[model samples]
Target chain A: MKKLKRSARLVEMTQYLLSRPHTLIPLTTFADRYGAAKSSISEDLVIIKEVFEDEGMGELQTHAGAAGGVKFIPKMPKDQALIFAEELCRQLQQKDRVLPGGYLYMSDLLGQPSLMNEAGKIFATAFADQEIDVVMTVETKGIPLAYATGAQLNLPVVLVRRDHQVTEGSAVSINYVSGSHKSIHTMSLSRRALKEKSKVLIVDDFMKAGGTIQGMVDLLAEFDAEVAGVGVLVESGEVESEERLLRDYVSLATLAGVDSKSKEINVKPGNYFSK
Target chain B: MKKLKRSARLVEMTQYLLSRPHTLIPLTTFADRYGAAKSSISEDLVIIKEVFEDEGMGELQTHAGAAGGVKFIPKMPKDQALIFAEELCRQLQQKDRVLPGGYLYMSDLLGQPSLMNEAGKIFATAFADQEIDVVMTVETKGIPLAYATGAQLNLPVVLVRRDHQVTEGSAVSINYVSGSHKSIHTMSLSRRALKEKSKVLIVDDFMKAGGTIQGMVDLLAEFDAEVAGVGVLVESGEVESEERLLRDYVSLATLAGVDSKSKEINVKPGNYFSK
Candidate 1:
């Protein structure tokens, strides 16, 4: 790369940092890339850092010392996140989304990359402080949300398959009762998918009676992995407190009620916004 | 938002453009956000555009006129994309990834956000010129890759479920023969999931006899949609040329052969690299 002017360097540096979130890059890397001095790189970073903070894009953490550099920690400010969550609640409340069995159709919302990306940013923000080694989610609908969070957190995503497949190699399978339907289902994970004793962050598109999430929690025990955190895009608020299989999770929206006959749906911002 | 310094504005402008790819943003939006003149915003975009192109980040397309703005079209240099494809081929060639029945375990590579993002860039670059409205793929394995491609192309992703779900409402299902297994399997998509006559870009993780890709193409026909393009991460080289179900698709890597007894997996860059 040839030497670039400060303006070009700033734009490139901002892009480099944005693309590689949660990874530390040495100042010298930028210095070398631009054919500039360390002091000049530092000055450029200071300007970038201020804009990031001021705009609430995220935090640029700089470490001092011979081996130190900077890391970009992506974050969504609480106020902005609240607004986005409220907007999601409104979207989820559409009457047509109600299904025959009181189920709400959310596949359309989950299919939107920009929407999922925003939700991922919120989940990433919610769990930024946790020591999460990987983002875990079930197969099917949850995959997109899981990947979204993983992208923002710069962590690899591990998917739990609903049925065992030969292509997965050796795997651990477990049976758990679905809380909503009271039906037994099997979920499995490849042995090589997750490391032993890894601090895992569980994510899902929706949680009903918390059975699937609890099933995942139980499955994690087989791998000697710890549940660092759990986050969901939506949670069913109709589940009785005692009937819910798990507690202590973050949700962006809560499905309060669904009247299939009347085609009425009620949704509100999830517990993410504490009143 | 208050007015920012020129350096700060440039940094903010770059971040904004990178985050919203392929979407046109009027210069007035930036001008208002930074409380700057349109002339100043134009100058800032010039710097960002030059850096984006020079660094192979992508291209910033500017449209002039009242409704005109700028759109970020992500691209990966052909040489760099080939290098990445070669690296992926090497990773897929590992003996441990060779499972029984000649199936290669690639969940690990697909789980990586960074790697998938890079692959997404390559696929996006491959289909950037196509008239694509949405990205389509099957359930489970292909969801991540589809979403990644969707993110890069600034498009929505529609998933085809293996089994129809009640929550999906009315759906159109079709049974397609599995290319490699020679077994019939059902794949369905919700009627409401996609608009009629959409231009669709099909993406998948693997293709053998192109049965699954063909299945998606068949399903698109039901919706009166057009197949704008097709991209796969890996394609099987063992499939007889005459027996292949589909033609004219892009692949990043090719699985030349898999020796189950000796556990030798031969892999190479796919047709993406003409040479």
Candidate 2:
């Protein structure tokens, strides 16, 4: 059989793996395709896997079962998830984060990849173990995180716009008093966004008053889909009422209170990975 | 004709604008359709505009031009983008962020809504002035930021999954060496993910060697798509590479270096939100 050296072989292996997210491909097939021995292919896989593993690149899951082979989990460990959350929280505490209304200045972080990546990990871990069919977030603020968690899990993310669209054609919208705003807000998901009985994980950037959160909760009820978990970038513990109904929440930062002046911000550890 | 109170009014307004991202809509339309007076519609639009604008909920663009009225830009200011990038950078600096072999721990922030929302804003700012037809990210890590940025611009995110599944009828693939490991990796995009001349922005969670980024870049060439910009969650600066040519980049943290033993890690900010 023709043989290729380390560099050439490694590229072929990764390219093959990259094309497939989580499905397992046996060693025998790879060996034949690469025109290398099974042992050689095995060795190459080890080298490639180790390099990627060290770099937090997508994973290579090897199964020993008769039908088992190598599969990529595309995952990051739990510890990795927490370190990221804590780091973002620290940055959020800086004096410059003080917005005009005492809100944490988060524009930079939101536009950044490091913080976004870490946040993705936290939510991914939150839903990592859950058998989720789709990742859902209300339109606007929640779309980015929802898409990230969905990517990590190899699931499709559906955006629930606050209003219906011509493309959606039909939708189910519910009016609920925002947990934070105390004023009513409408939350909606298109008829095509989801299917019945989907195990969903709901995520958003912030939960102030949670009118949107509860609105999503109510929207989920409309579809009869199970809420697998609820996660947010930041959670306001100050919001009154409706706290008991939440299950499986992960917040990177908890705003105890943004001082009246907005200059002094108090933050506590969030529910993310704290459990 | 008939009218709704503030809460109901805001929800309805938010829903309408979100459905038509990057498209212009006249205020008179909302006024006439809601059966409310133009003055009442103006008040509602003002409130809708303020909430999304103040909170970075979304961009509200009001064009007084003869051809325009009120259009949501789906964007926020640059200063806000910088704040988020800095916040994420500070967060990634924690000691606990250390992983095996001097690697930094990540993945949490990438998936978080808070961070992703910030990341999305940054990209929206970059492309806010550009006309992007679609947002593209290779499957897995880049998905969240890609989706978030896409939503902010009101564009549909297209994923370039590894394999050609039944759902993805056909695809184009490319091969490139991963910057991190010097291993060749194949990257792919579904044939239907985008169209020719589609303005694409490539986003990912991390950029160690940028091999994956390069692969995706090369992959886009296969589809005849133009890359408007390239964005990443985190980038490693200290590391040398033989990766593809890159035009633009946004990352939370850029690794400075590691101690001789790969301990005592150091990181500097990437070009994210550099005014």
Candidate 3:
């Protein structure tokens, strides 16, 4: 690589850090790549740190000594997260999104990368302090959200399948009754998908009676994995307290109520704000 | 944003452009954003553009005249893409990945966000010139890849489910024969997921006999959508030419052959390099 001027170097360095989040890069690596002095690299980092904070683009943590360097931690500011949640609620409140059984048509929102990225950042920020080994989610809808959050945290995403696929080799399948309909459903996970005793964060697109989440929690026990946290895009606010399958979970939006007869729906920011 | 200095402004602008790929932003927008003159914003973009090109982080396309700004087109250089494909092949060639019926265990690779991001960038670059409105993929495995590609292209992703769910409302389901086994399989897409005559880019995790890809193409016909392109992460080389259902597509890696008895597998870079 040719030696670049300070301006060019800054732009490259910023992109590099943004692309590889949660990974430490020593100062010597950058110094050698740019053929710049260690002191100059330090000064450049300081500028990046200030701008990163000013723009709310997470923190650029710096470590001193020979073995230490810098790491980028993606985070969403509380106020910004609230704004996003509010916006999501507004989108969710649309009457057309309400299905026959009170299900929201959120596939459009989940499909948008920009929106998913924001949600991912919020989840990453919420679990930033936790020791999470991997992000877990059920097959289908939650895959994108899980991947986005995993990208932000620089962690691998492990998917739990609805049905056992032959390609996955050996697997563990468990049946649990759905909290909403009291129907039995089976969820499976590849033996290779997760390691025993790993700390996992569960994410999902929607939570109706919290049955699906509970199933995941129970399934994790088979792998001897610990559930570090659970995050959902939307949760059913009408679920009775006693019927709720899970108690501790984070939600971005709440489906307060819906009037199928009048085609009216109500949504509010989830417990994320209160937390 | 507060009036940041030139250095800070550059950092902020870089991050902003990177996040919103393929979206046009006028110079005045940036000028107003930073409370700086258009001339200054133009200068900042020049630095960003230079670094973006030099670092192979895609192109910063600038449009002149009123109502014109810049668009970030995510791309992967040919050399870098080859290197990525080679790495993927090495990973796929592991004997342990070979399952009964010649399926490869690639969930671990697909679960890694960094790897998916790279594959996404490569697909984005390959189809950058195409006028694509949305990215389409099947449920479960292909969702992440589709989402990553959609993120790069700044487009929405539409997932075609194997089984219809009540939450999806009215859906269109079609049965297609598996090209390899001639077995019938069902795929469903929500009526609301796609628009009529929309240009779609189909992406998938793996392709064998191209049966699934063909199914998606046929399913798009129901929506009156056009298949602009098809991209797959891995394609089976063992599929005889006479059995191939589709030929026009791009693949990142090729599963050349697998010897289940000896626990030996062969993999190579896909058609992407040849093209």
Compose the digit string of candidate 3's lDDT tens values, residues B15-103: 99999999999988888888998899999999999999988899999887787889999888999999999999999888899888767
Ranking by DockQ: 1, 3, 2
Q: Once superposed on the true structure, which residue ranges of model 1 sit more than 4 Å away at CA? A: none
lDDT tens per residue, model 2, A1-275 = 43555444554465456435456799887877768887887777776666556546557788886797897666656677666766766776776555444555453455443355457666765666688887788755455567656655666676776665443436798887754335776767766567899898888887776567767777888888888888898887676555433545778778777764646666776876567
Model 1 has a DockQ score of 0.89
The DockQ assigned to candidate 3 is 0.86
The lDDT values for all models are: 0.92, 0.66, 0.92
Give the CAPRI rating of model 2.
incorrect
Pick the DockQ winner: 1
- The second chain of candidate 3 has a TM-score of 0.98
lDDT tens per residue, model 3, A55-159? 788999998888899999988899989999999999888888878776678888888987998999999999998999999999888888999999999999999
Share of native interface contacts recovered by each model: 0.88, 0.03, 0.84
